[model samples]
Target: MTVVGFRSSIGTWGCAIGLIGLTLCWPAITPVSPAVALADEPAAAETPPDQPENDGSTETDSQETPSTGRTLEDAPTLERQVLTELESAPHWPARALAAIRLERFDCAPTRDRLIEFVQHDPDWRVRANAIRSLAERSIEQGEGWFEEEAEPRVIRTALRYGYEVDAGRVHRGVRFLLRSNRLDERLLGAEIAAASGKDDLVADATDTVRSVILRMDRAQAGLLSPRLSAMTGVRGLFSRQDWMRWFRENGRRVELAETRRDPPNPHPPPAGERSFLAELNVDAFARFESYVQQWPELRIDLVFALDCTGSMTPVFSRTQSIISDTMLFLQDITESPRFGLVAFRDVDQEFVTRPFRLTQDAEEIMLQTWLQEAVHGGRQSESVLAALHDSYAMSWREHVERLVILIGDGPPHRGEGGACIRLAERARTRGGIRTQVVEPINAPVRDFKEIAEAGGGRLWTLDDYVLILAELLGLERSDDIDQAFMAFIRHYTELLR
Candidate 1:
């Protein structure tokens, strides 16, 4: 197994390319930048090199973007460069590659480097890599780092890695992060709790998890004035302890416990209450004045595959309204998000808009007006199967979820919609893609199963469009959304019951 040893001045140097060798198979990571050679040069990210986050600041003062003139080779070339560079140096970037490689390899040096990075690395993402690297090694050693319990990202990374590489650790980590006030940390905790297959781990938080949460709570409160509401985000991160205990007492399956809906409040429903799902993701977005306020996860990409066909005229009209609302919603969110649009016709799908921030009122207005101009002229000869099968070519990205909401009501003109569904399935399973299909009632049920199964997505009938759209946006905390996610999990696990 290939593993990282340490960082040196000459970029990332590698000893063995044991497991990192597998990355060579991916065929895309070619043309890595030449080694900077010095101990100090601007790192590839926007922030300055190796600065710890403190005082509620996530970034450093420097905005040193990696030199962009360097053109990337195709996937295979990318893989060759990554493999060659990682094997040659133990610099930060090399260490990063080694960490990922160690996920497939393992050794004492790699483990130690990971531990050191987790404890001392200034970059959160680098630390994130260290946690992931350790978890991968834990696959064999079975004894991962118990010392990183205090860090939220470490805890979250542990939970994810644990579920895949070690169930017990994942179980423990989930509870630890759930009791964290940091929403990102807590949400990650929820994902871990939901993912753990072990009945005990899923059913009960370990003493370690409890201790971690308590310590984190204390840490957040300055280790002096322990407060109550401050604990709720962390506390509710996992379901109430009583709920878990009850699930254990009832001998419920871990899967069932996970899929079960949150309990209805004892308090009466407020009069004239409206379902968040009914509002539509495009519409509810209007509520957030800022990207951070609009969603718990900060990064968002809105991609619309609009149908340009005679039958889809009305559906396209609704698309127009959603587009307007989305533009307004963008204004509230952070400047980081990107919005893009595509028009699908009978023969092919094309990009009519580029990713731009809603922060620019002029840009948003132009975007909406552009959406109007393109909606009509695009021909409808393209097949839904063809449009999506080729989507990865246009919109794929790393570290962020890609949401492709297709508005249409028929089979693809090229390959069967079944092909597109299979492709979608692969993307979401890898956590790099998501697809939501909207179609008219009489379109076709045969393809619905394919899209839903492969894409790890939901297929909505236009008649029930409101319900499905809400679920897509994750707006309602209800049964439909619950089942929709159950479908989501089914994509991840084969033993669907």
Candidate 2:
């Protein structure tokens, strides 16, 4: 809860590169002090093969001793003093050793000293360095203090020190600027400003000021990342305000309108729709999950082929649970597949979810939060097939098994749906992908059945749609999953054998 930091020895820009700034406060009794930097691209570095990569994986060497140990436990001296500097450690490119070292030693006094420097230090770079220190230390609890902002520590540090490169901070500040109508006020103390009086952004984003302003306007106009907003139901694509408030006032109203608008289907399914649930047990799904779990020599991946044509409006309404639910299913699975979602319509396409290598649990909560606040979509060609092809072609990571999950009303617009099935078949034949189709019954299944068969994937009707989704993504099957999974697994086993 303590928001603290100190400048590092490196200069301001150095803080941006190696990102070594804050030395957050901890309980250790003693203290020391520091100062600012920038430098060449972080020097290519190496650590013991067991050590972490430059990208911070070193924080996870699995060698990290959990802090559950009692406070009295002995602490290891930081192997070396000069090398202890993370932002400027010259020899090793400052591996996780530096960050890990900070974790063990009580840096509270150092953190306090950093805070003091930021508040009083004349050099904006020095203040920037102070925040860098805090950013490095924010993960003390593993669960980030990152509220909706994701990095209050770093943003405050960036604001204090005058660097603005992080996409998050840039967007956050833009949102604030829009809401406050006080761009100049927020720009006060804006150290990173250029002669144009606009804040100097990160090198990667040097040209986005005008663009960002436009984005802000679009967000205000409710037109940013319709795909993301639709999937997450998170209004204000980039609208900046106390979102929780926006969520309460506007979110509640939208939700109420939605509920009222979509009266319950007069034809709810009978309670006894599915009685003998043979697929509920793992015996039925051993090969499916086990194969997926052990698929990769090292990793596996998942992709969601979401639909977003105008016809899908009602589907989105009833299917707000799709994204959140699928994400949770990924969490329940033993194999943590890198996940991404691709929502497509011909004229307009939204990657809304990009493919990334990460465990399902890591993404599930955020995906759920995203879905709860996301918006519905726009109109376009029912291009499920084209979206899959392009997404696969564009993906760079080599995954073990590419699971393309198609979430749409069964089939596509007339003469347009076969591309998806063909793409799935191609992925399976050459790339070892395991394709599955979670099609809805809202549209005709006439074309969907052929599509599913062609792709060698399973097809399910949207009865207890959410439950079907659960099993397809390996979630806990409620009812439909039990029925549908059995059929799918059996077919897969028969075909593979």
Candidate 3:
């Protein structure tokens, strides 16, 4: 079999380069490139409504016909070719790419085809891409479509896109995700519900909501409490029992105040009203102090599986610093912290993977030595799957918070048919190891997202390591940390604009 490498501008992230029939290389973040000519099809008499308006200048045109030696007259022909590919492309990747390309077209036919893909596409990747494109264009497919979608990834895409086409659909989707067994999905549901400020979104699922609250650790509960309080019109409650009791007692009668103005004073101040605020403040302070006292007893085991291939040379030093800083931070919060390392390269490299078993803080020096000794030399695709398998087999502490952070810049060798995702699922189900994937800049995200979802963790960028570490460790509550995280997100949003 002959392998060919070709780059095609798929979506907003950047171009995807196909290598060895499986690998996809995501270039660094940049503006969406002009559409490439896929095929030589007959021109249509009238231009589609979604087609970009053609101007004389090459810079302003959205099509790459001029560079390809084709004329601007072939713009409609190119649209037909892309639409045809979306409908009948034999390979799933081609179909997925076509769906991404259709984002530039917002006509009825483009929307109808994308909606069909969302409803009936055999591949989940294709369906996810289609739904994302629709959401990006802000074209709603009405109700009952996204609400009934069963795949967690597709539902997550809708949630990330804030697909509020219909309130009922969004409510149903949130309910479904809240009930999901995956921790990441449930967390996302809680975040969306709290952010949406829709008090009735989880009205009937009080028990499920309480369970989610009960599962959260101290830091998580602290960060989420104020927002949830604002949404539920309740304050100073921490435990699940307190929340449920309040819901049962005053949930239906209490309505969120419509105005910010102070309520009218009672003719005669109620008894104990003078001390109520003081008492609540004292109770909240006591609860936080108790959590702080228990922090030292928490146990955690973390393994870092890094792709030590030549391509990662540019960002490898930064990766090392992130890992080191995380370890130092963990030591401050927990008395018992175990660390491990797995450095991986390609099959033909000096070594495919060098793994260091989970060791206590006393042996941190050895782990750092192994990490620094890794040499970067290999093909584009490294032995990522092999490294994950090794990391899962490490001597993880039983009953501790087990975590694996996989940092890489490309896909696994030959893709391995999603073997890494399967391994992550097995580790989560049998070993309770939550796997997080950290991509540097423009790494391909589809495979990493799937693996993280399977392992009940979220995919994060390299810049988010501090926040990720803080969340996983349930570190001390600090307003600065929260503000920094939100600011980073806003920065990314501005870049998208």
Name the best candidate (by lDDT): 3
- Model 3 residue 34 CA deviation (Å) reads 58
Candidate 3 stretches with Cα past 4 Å from truth are 1-291, 362-378, 415-417, 475-481, 484-497
Candidate 2 residue lDDT tens string, 197-264: 23333321223222322333212222122222322345433333323344456533322101001111
Question: What C-alpha lDDT values do all the predictions have?
Answer: 0.40, 0.37, 0.54
Model 2: worst 10 consecutive residues (lDDT sum) = 255-264
**Of candidates 3 and 1, the better by lDDT:** 3
**What's the residue-level lDDT of 287 in candidate 2?**
28
Best by TM-score: 3
lDDT of 2 at 387: 50
19-95 per-residue lDDT for model 3 (tens digits): 10111122221111112111112234465799875432222122221122212233355455444644585445446
TM-scores for all candidates: the values are 0.33, 0.35, 0.39
Residue-level lDDT of model 1, residues 362-436, one tens digit each, is 234323323332233334234666556445445544555467666666555445555676677776776566777
What's the distance in Å from true for residue 379, model 2? Answer: 7.6
